[model samples]
Target: MPDFTTDHTEPAADRVERFQAAASTAFAPLLVRAHDGPPFHATIRAQATGGLLVSDIRTSPVTVNRPAGRISSSDNDVYKVALQLSGTMGVAQDGRREVMRPGDLAVYDTTRPYALEHFAAPDGEIRTVVIACPRHSFAAGPDALREVVATPVPATRGVTGLVAAFFTGLADELPNVDASGTHLADALVDLISLTFATPPRPDPSALTARMIAYCEANLSDPTLSPRTVARAHHISVRYAHRLFAETDRSLASWIRSRRLDRIRRDLENPLLAHRTVAAIAARWGLYDAPHVSRLFRATYGVSPTTYRRAHSGGF
Candidate 1:
């Protein structure tokens, strides 16, 4: 598994330099901004797995200028899916103008010409989550998907929402992945395939539910957070909180419980005999051995080591 995370706050000039340096390597630049100043207060994370590239980006107010043409330098074909995480984004593609609000998703082909303008408040910024997949990898035909590309599609419901949620959840858990990273990556591909196979509809609640399930499946990740989950679903931190609240659990507590469950399972696995209790806990994002021991005792009424010793015989 390959993971990269960058958090930066620098002067406009330095920031632009960094942005250009980063973008030039991965994405082609027609017109790079932050020229006036770095208007984008941004957190950008990108993950590549099973031929899919997912990026979670939250930016301060800024304008990205792309003239009506594809970058002549890059020949790679990518289908870009952008979900508005906060505020609004105005996108113009093939002479059609679309306004994307929170919970809305839009797709654009890297082979075409389009312009995206991210709106910001006097003191606020715009946030978005973007997933880029090879055009050939999408389950639906390129033409079939193109009809919705660059147009505002609702993600608060239906298959699109489910897909958004899956991507977000996967992003959060990418860092803690171990030998099972390949399986997780394959699962993500399957989810994306499901998303493209479903008919479009409006069901934000349904999407949130699917997202919760995805999170549950990957609870061992220490990097999981409300922000990461929300970004996956193309929503806000507050909105992600609301979804969990509906389930009667805060995000943090839910993650903790998930880690505990994984530890419990590991304790019983005779094949994992060589791995220590602390190693298992750390694999699931529990860094402090003492803390894991304490939490295990509080929840399961026994220390992890004791639990492992008792359960190991069963396997």
Candidate 2:
């Protein structure tokens, strides 16, 4: 195992520069802003075991951004799982904002943009354990991962609790190790894989929930349909329909509604103002511009352009 640690005695006057350099060495290049200004306080303890890097980050008030401009095509091979141990942090990614309290955990992809801001802790410092692994080392595929990204998983009781307990306990005991990560990496990978697995003999509601999650994760795919969803879950199209019958709407209707909803959401988001109406529509799988215009008029009583103007003050 390779270990790196930032000394706490380092002078605060120049800590920001030292912190950024140490951070980049510990993990990747991250845009770290010190909310407390000069005389900042932060420390990082990072350990590497094969393809996995576990980091214990303790810092004062700060906001971290993994900007899109900093990401390269070759730099997106890792996924980061964060376990909040002793503080509150707001995690923003994939259009979802989650406030993760102690014992809450979530995963995020390094390939995309994400932001994290730490709140004031009881001890005036925030502590979080983050583990990074190569995407190939993880069991879940990209599509499946989209559902869980930035989505907080409570660590009360279940596989999630087990993961939380294991990592938190590891943070407390890793200092005693004999400088070896013999099985630590493999165990972490197996634990995470178990967390992502589907439970055995799931009920109809659970299965339906899984199907809906699949749909939500792949809303941008034009080929995402009842048949494709059924195939993804290893069920027949009829069985998929039967499951959807339990819901208020049919599977196909739900898909269409969700796609339009995503488009409308993007149009209303000022952060996405750079995207054209057609581009936003296509991003959610509605590729036909004229058809989408008609659908928007029929659904919202306004064209997409007008709707964007009304909601987001034009794009």
Candidate 3:
């Protein structure tokens, strides 16, 4: 991969304009603005390694915005994973905000709206290594990725620290690895992905049981979902699904079955027979009438109304 470096002695304004264009060209559509005054300096040294676009940036104070108006399905799904090498950066997305210091890691989706501010230090410059990774190449699916966007993955220790160290080393090695850097790039991505994954547990069964218990307790909540369950259990959506793979049904189907079972129990209770099918369904968080009817018929070989009538002597 041939490296491209842009650092010219043009006027401060022209330098900003050219830097903004170059930054956008290097990544996706971005509005880059120089934050400090005249004679501002910046450089963007970019290289493509494996399937990743790595940009080593050193610039004066600047702010970058990814606007909603510029977002489209046709726009690339590559996410920007920034490793703060020097100074600080403020990141905002999905209504969450955080400031990243040196050795910190953060990711942002290109297809969504986000904001970034590269703040100047006492030395009057900030440096960052930004890697662009496509959605498919990433290990975490979209849901998991959304869980982490604009959220700082601190490089204080452990796997995150190791990942940050790799990026720091890659900055110097990137200029020389055009011929043999693909494997290294891939490993770095995998490690970073692992850093964002759920923390390890000694027993999958225990976690699964706890997650199931949470789902059962929250069945009356209309917003109950796999994602919500995962959040409640402090796990990943993918891991939550994996935990239920050996169960009687998939996680989603199991939730539906449990809700249907509760609805049936309620309908069979003679004291509760006055409640309508829709009302009973809603009581158990099965809110969509037509969809719930289809599920109920498919599961019990009868519609909710028929089942309720037969169970309660013609309700």
Q: Which predicted model would earn the best lDDT?
A: 3
Per residue, candidate 1 scores C-alpha lDDT tens digits across 23-75 of 43454454556423444455566666656666666565555655546466455
C-alpha RMSD values across all candidates: 17.0, 13.1, 12.6
Which candidate, 1 or 3, has the higher lDDT? 3
Provide the lDDT at 209 for model 1: 70
Per-residue CA lDDT of model 2 for 1-315, tens digit only, reads: 234444557765467677776765655667887786435777677666656777888887778888888887756378888999877998888876767788878888888899998887787768999888788887778887776677666677777888998888767665653335748777888888776543454699989999999999999999999867875674546668889998899999999989988888889999999889999999988899999999888889999999999999756
Error of 3 at 237 (Å): 20
> lDDT tens string, model 3, 84-186?
9888999999876777888779888898899999887777669999888888888888887788787666687888889888877777776765734678778
Give me candidate 2's TM-score against the actual structure.
Answer: 0.59
In model 3, the runs with Cα more than 4 Å from the true position are: 1-9, 200-315
Give candidate 1 regions above 4 Å deviation.
1-11, 35-40, 68-70, 121-123, 177-315
Q: Which ten residues in a row have the lowest lDDT in candidate 1?
A: 1-10
- Model 3: lDDT equals 0.81
TM-score of 3: 0.61
